[model samples]
Target: LHSYTKYNTWDTILSWINSIASSNPSLVSKQVIGNTFEGRPMTLLKLGKSSGTTKPSIFLDCGIHAREWISPAFCQWFVKEALETYGSDSQMTSLLDQMDVYVLPVINIDGYEYSHTTNRMWRKTRSKLSGSSCLGADPNRNFDAGWCTVGASSNPCSETFCGSTPESEIEVKHVADFIRKNKSSIKAYLTIHSYSQLLLFPYSYSYNLAADHSELMSVAQGASAALTSLYGTRYTSGPGASTIYLAAGGSDDWAYDLGVKYSYTFELRDTGYHGFLLPESQIKPTCEETMLAVKYIAAHVVFSQ
Candidate 1:
């Protein structure tokens, strides 16, 4: 059995997804949003009590960058924590009772698998382009928001290659389509990434602030505070372009453009000493502290709705 505190291979994660949902029928269910370039099923785990209707939900996805193993680790940890603490942890209890959390545990399945087995630093999807020898596009830059305009590359071989076009990668299209279909009910969009220890909101394509800038900043500040409270691990909170580098076509920006106002991207864990190679020994603490920030955001979404 794969432990939630450690990184697991795609096969192990796939099995874990099936087993976890099957074991907790009432609290969780799996949805196959779409398949990847390698035809691996991209499964989504829905976490919430049986509400008999589609309630307001938060969409959280991880592993968009194949090299960020901690990203997927946090997703699995979030689900495990939510399930294990639902009734015991009042915040988690209330969040589940009132709102659903849709989690895509691993977005770049092929790339992630490749990273584990071939190269530890592989960071893009594994799709073969029609005319170029390049294998994949940066899934983060494959969205429709200000795509390939800034901080992204036009060359197919570049690490930050923004696909041939927005949603050119099947994985990106799959996620975009699902969010579009549930845009009305998804109150928040949170995409997990690693090594920066920062929380950012949209407008990455430009210096312009999101329409709900102040509110998003406030929520991110609160979540950052919540995260810091657990272990004094600091996280800078601000707009993406200004807080970090400007990255176009990110899912957070795209979802925000689609009207999911509370869109945020979390660059998790240590500043840079570890980078994408975050240790398994730190997984527990990282996930535990991250849980606080995530719960804070989820609680805000549940009550704000």
Candidate 2:
């Protein structure tokens, strides 16, 4: 059992994924989707009851921004809980029986390492953009939804830099490519971020609403209610741009645009007392409530299908 009491390094997290997959051969497996600019492997954990045919899937990726340590912790905790409770927990059992989950535990491995070793607040990929002195671009802003417009910055040094072009960050590109390739099978896209308890959907790039706005809002409201019922962790659920900021090129919006109607962005935990430095003590409770919210969405996906 990997304790959620401490933040592990990139290598240690990878080890946990590989070890869990090996130990639970029938329930979980992993694949190296792509490599970061610093040569770190971007691994995805595939969780499901072994079945030959494809099932509807929900893709949950965490730690896209490096400083948000708790995001990756949730991913690890969710995986452990999913495997441990598959037989005992009714919701998890039914979810695994009817659907599959693919989790990218640490998407920005290079930047995560940098946050641990050098800067304690690094939030971008470590990729050195050509002809620029700045070392990285915000992976969130590197998606194709709105490219380098609106809330995104054009300067490479800015924290919200959208990069030279869409899909400029290799990490973002890897996720986009994988989702694009698996778009048909994937019914939901859940990307986890932090420092604000929000359950957001598409149209972060524009004020316009998603085509499936009504259904998405209904499900998100139900999931948010489920999450709050656990620990009273209140989450405002709505469109990303309106609920949060107008940050464009988000993976949530991109995935929604790619035809994954259930795309969501979960800004988890505190509204900013701890910010990116969320303590290890809060990990278990956070993960517990978050699991409820995630399962709620999963149930909705399964039932609706």
The lDDT of each candidate is 0.94, 0.90
lDDT of 1 at 41: 100
Among the numbered candidates, top TM-score falls to: 1
Residue 4, candidate 1: Cα error in Å is 1.5
- Candidate 2 residue 56 Cα shift, in angstroms, is 1.2
For model 2, how does the per-residue alpha-carbon lDDT over 1-305 read when each residue is reduced to its tens digit? 45666788887898888899999999998999999988988989999997789988999999999999999999999999999999999999999988999999999999999999999999998988778999898988889987777899999889998988999888888889999999899999998999799999998988898899999999999999999998899999999888877988889898988899899899888889998888899988899999988999999899989
TM-score of each: 0.99, 0.98
Clashing pairs in 2: none
Candidate 1 lDDT (Cα, 0 to 1): 0.94
Clashes of 1: 0
